[model samples]
Target: MAIFTENIGKVSVGKAVTWDRDAALLYALSIGAGRPDATEGIDYTTESSFGIQQKVFPTFAVVLGGSGGSMDHLGDFKLHQILHGGQSLVLHCELPPQGSVTPRSYMSAVYDQGKNAIIELTTELADPEGQLVATSVTSMVIRGETGYGPRPERAGSWAEPGSEPDAVIEQATSVDQALLYRLNGDRNPLHSDPVMASKAGFPRPVLHGLCTYGMAALALVRNSTLLAERGLGSINARFAAPVFPGQVLETRIWNTAAGALFQVLADGKIVLDRGVATAAAAVAQDAAELQDAAAN
Candidate 1:
């Protein structure tokens, strides 16, 4: 508890991050974006389409700031016992197809949850002019590292709507989905090495939580023009269960006046729940930005 609290609010050195059109396209394809049966979102997958201009997916912010892996400032903990508990992101504006940003990250809080502990991290991504681009909040659960005293305040139970879903979309994940997603910066062996997965008590390598979250966002944006017009203003969800590769994910969404509530199910079990997404106002793309994206 002492170590965790002491590190809170201490900003780490900023890291310069850059991405190109290829990276944006790869991120889109990794999240099951471009398919023959896809109704929309070709702009995300193709760089030089006729009338469509390529755009970055809002969920791509997860990789823009990179994972908070430099945890030595905090006390040592078992790596295998850690898992992504939840993820949230708020985009300040539409991300260009290619751009650069400097990510400033810091430990936000630590909550003790009986046999586990939840470490919260906040990262701010900014452009070269120091304008905020996106803010990300990540919760990491460390098993068997509890008893430090502070317990997180319980959030209200998420009740499912009684009416039928507004939309239900099923997407298939490729067997190499995790492998492809790892190229985005997360190289955790738990998502790749079968031996490491077994040691962590899993039958096999599991898909990245961010990947699953991105897929959920993909389903929503592809299905609803209202949400995809500009891009997602914000989105958040809790990781309830592990999603193995090659499994089909069914995302059920319930439309609300503000935005929507959603859940992702794998084989009838909820893998992501307590979801919320807000749509951003549609913005026209600038030709200069498009040309810059193409050049770099």
Candidate 2:
């Protein structure tokens, strides 16, 4: 295995990436928006007062400064065997309708867990003007790839659900989700061309994992009834299963003192298991004070 300790600092992966209207449209389509049968019925492409504006999906930050060949460099790691363990994003500002963005990525930390290795990466995106647009932190748990030496300490997992969720929100994907998402400049082919997918060991074209992540975010924003209350502060989730296009995703949420717990289920199976989001405490505090004043 490669020791990335020396690489755990500021690293530039790519130059300025142009963000345009087409990119925004594709991202919206990837997440099941703008479909003929969409439940939300929001036209993201058109200038509308409702629905998300022509903005890049928050989760796009993960791919921004990605090193094209990290897996190849890591010895003994079967790239196919590795999975995206979790994703989280913090938006510093609303994505502009169109602009150029430069991202700086770096290895934030590495945790050796005896049986597994947990790698953390962070990327910061800035507009041409040097204004911060967004920041993302991703954690990848390399299962069964550990024991190079003594283990390191890491944060504990989120508290497991002690009871059933309080509410469940369901959203179905359009059959063209993968195809549309690819237009967002991903061009991975794994999500579109069937031949490519088969080569990757998938039965058929699978939706971009990030597409599902965006859908889960939409579910959380809608279900928590906090879209207008709390600006999206943070979203963290694990991809439990591959969701093909045209599958219905059911997101279950539980309100907590810290934030909200969530899970995305498809066809009665948990696809995004063990998800959690932390909202800005400032909003929650303000809401509480309003409630107290009303009670008085």
- Model 1, residue 167: displacement in angstroms? 1.4
Candidate 1 runs further than 4 Å off: 1-3, 36-39, 147-160, 224-230, 281-296
lDDT of 1 at 127: 94
Query: Per-prediction TM-score, please?
Result: 0.87, 0.79
Task: Evaluate residue 79 in candidate 2 and report its C-alpha lDDT on the 0 to 100 scale.
Answer: 62
- Model 2 poorest ten-residue lDDT run: 66-75
> Which prediction has the highest TM-score against the true structure?
1
Task: Candidate 1: give the clashing pairs.
Answer: none
Q: Rate the local accuracy (lDDT) of all candidates.
A: 0.83, 0.68
Report the Cα lDDT for residue 66, model 2: 50
